[model samples]
Target: MKKMFAVTALVSAFSFSNVAMADEDIGCGLGTMVFDGKSGKVHKVLAATTNGTSGNQTFGITFGTLGCDGTGTITSSQKLAMFIDGNMDNLARDIAKGEGETLATLSEVWGIQDADKIAFNAVAQENFATIFASENVTSTEVLVNLNDLIAQNEALASYRI
Candidate 1:
């Protein structure tokens, strides 16, 4: 009787172990999108794709800024332009350590180890577009999250926005 209870408890514990080990969904900013009006209100933010492709479209958000245009809205395009927001070398080091120090990690991380180390890649069309879009210029204070960037890295499973 006591032995039966112990066996059932052990089995139940094992059954629940896998669920406990499930990976947490890490939110990383791939990079920021900035719409510099050249005269009107400027906007910027970290971006995410709907279906993980340009065909899928995108969405974005600024962390600290407040305003109607503060959120960066993404658009579909064959190609985009952007600039590196952080030190690439530093971004690589964090990824090698299985960590991220910056707001955006995809470029810096992938630049160091490729898709094997992270979840996304610059080579893939979907990732490439995102990276390109992130590099787009905007007003100061716009930043990217390393985790968001790494979420798209190929080593990890692709994510839904």
Candidate 2:
């Protein structure tokens, strides 16, 4: 049981270390957001030390793959990009229709004022082709592309998190 205790302790320590780094992770590339509701540097060492040749299950188990910096100091464009990635399919369909519950969720998640959700939805719908060029897009790709579209619209650029 001592060996099991040691393993648990090590994992706990590693988890805490990563969680601790989320507070000041701005502009330092991007770190994995940990389960503790904080952002921290992605520790590739977990996979290395575990002595396994499997997929990135260790990292996925410990850290969420949302690609958010978790510092809560991100710009409006970045948050919108994250929203796009999270609500990709539903958002895409909503954009095509120019309205939906999913779009409302995106507006809520972005903290957009109720009065502005309609305009924002309209802008997103107008630029759906640019935002979602293809079905297969990476999170970073979504971020960059969404930011470009946000730049063209005043309402989107006004909402920042």
Expressed as tens digits, the lDDT of each residue in 1-161 for candidate 1 is 99879845643443343221111111122212122221222222222222123321222113211111224454211001122233444433443444555413443423443434333432232333333334432211122333355455555434312
Candidate 1: minimum summed lDDT over ten consecutive residues — where?
20-29
Which candidate leads in lDDT? 2
Q: Model 2, 1-161: lDDT tens per residue?
A: 99879855654555555433332212121223323343333443331222223222334333532232333456665666666756778877887888999888877776779988888788778888777778766546655665566666776686633
Pairs of residues clashing in candidate 2: 22-39
lDDT of 1 at 120: 40
Per-candidate local distance difference test: 0.31, 0.57
Steric collisions counted per model: 19, 1
User: What lDDT does candidate 1 reach at residue 90?
Assistant: 49
**What's the TM for model 1?**
0.20
User: Candidate 2: lDDT of 68?
Assistant: 21
Poorest lDDT segment (10 consecutive residues) of candidate 2: 22-31
